[model samples]
Target: MMVTNLCTSPSSTITLRADEWVNITTIPNKPGTKYWVSAYVNVTGGTISLSMYGDISASQHVSYQITAVNAGAMSMTYSVVSGSPTVTVTSMLICTFAEYQANKTLLDSIEYFDGDTMPRA
Candidate 1:
């Protein structure tokens, strides 16, 4: 059985006022596989906005991405972990078939200036 685990430290960190946004990305060292991803934030007075993408599966390794949008100085963190394959291997070592592997990818965050500017509907 093969397994891999990955995590992001500072699970929560402050973003300075000058900072527009926070972006994080992760690339697994292993081949095609699934991965589980999670994120949390700790903001005292102000509100914290968060966005995350990528495979959340525990069966294999996968690329992950996270972005945070905050009103003021705040802290946030994201994590990724991988687990064993979903398929079961028998003692006889008989060959079995499974679904084809698919690539997982995520996009980084993009900060927008001027809160007055509204998005197009």
Candidate 2:
């Protein structure tokens, strides 16, 4: 259940351009393990795309889950689709698989009620 910050510097942000991928950071890959990667970014002009461990995500605060299949470094990158945008990578985190499973277990234990009967599961 270890949590790690993947950004190289916390006080700085990276600006990206259209059709260009900017490398944020590269994290260590533990084979057979799962990691949840999330980032806090501000996008101006257009939306931005994020990629890590071959998994892709987009916009603002988003998380991408991926499993480590080999040993090495897993790099995270970002790109915009339209005009050059100023982006602030406020926070980036990589959570362990156990933490994810634990959160899922907690979510599964909850029952949502919509007035009279509970909503469909």
Candidate 3:
């Protein structure tokens, strides 16, 4: 149920280094469980590629998703695929599992989870 959200301020964003892979803060993980990852990024000055999440175009606002298999403080990474410019990361989330179950009704309006392998039981 631990959610590790990456962002500086409500109106600010993160800048990714050019030609390098960046891993935001890690999130809690449990083996044999499925976790959801979501992010809103602005890829400017280059094409940013994420690890298993997907890629974004220059000056685009994109939302991406990915699932994790690693346990204990897992991290999601992004890289610049083409241009030598950095990517602007708006908001990100490493959430799922317990938290979603506890807040099922409250969060249902926000996002939905299959919960089959979420460790809710």
Clashing pairs in model 1, backbone N/Cα/C closer than 3 A:
13-75, 13-76, 34-60
Candidate RMSDs in Å, in order, are 20.1, 10.1, 7.3
Model 2 lDDT tens row, 25-115? 4555789988765555666655555555222233455556878777665444466545655655545545565665666554234311111
Candidate 2 scores a C-alpha RMSD against the true structure in Å of 10.1
Superposed Cα deviation of residue 107, candidate 3 (Å): 6.6
* Residue 5 shift from truth in candidate 1, angstroms: 2.3
Q: Could you give me the TM-score of model 3 versus the true structure?
A: 0.53
The deviation in Å at residue 18 for candidate 1 is: 8.3
What ranking of all candidate models by lDDT puts the best one first?
A: 2, 3, 1
In candidate 2, position 54 carries an lDDT of 29
**Cα TM-score per model:** 0.24, 0.54, 0.53
Model 1 misplaced stretches (Cα beyond 4 Å): 1-3, 8-35, 53-121
In model 2, the runs with Cα more than 4 Å from the true position are 1-27, 51-59, 104-121
Q: Between the candidate structures 1 and 3, which one is better when assessed by lDDT?
A: 3
What digit string (tens of lDDT, one per residue) describes model 1 on residues 1-121?
2111232222223232212333222322222333333232222333322233333332222222322233222222323233321221111100001111121121112111111121111
Q: Count the backbone clashes (under 3 Å) in each candidate.
A: 3, 0, 1
lDDT of 3 at 73: 59
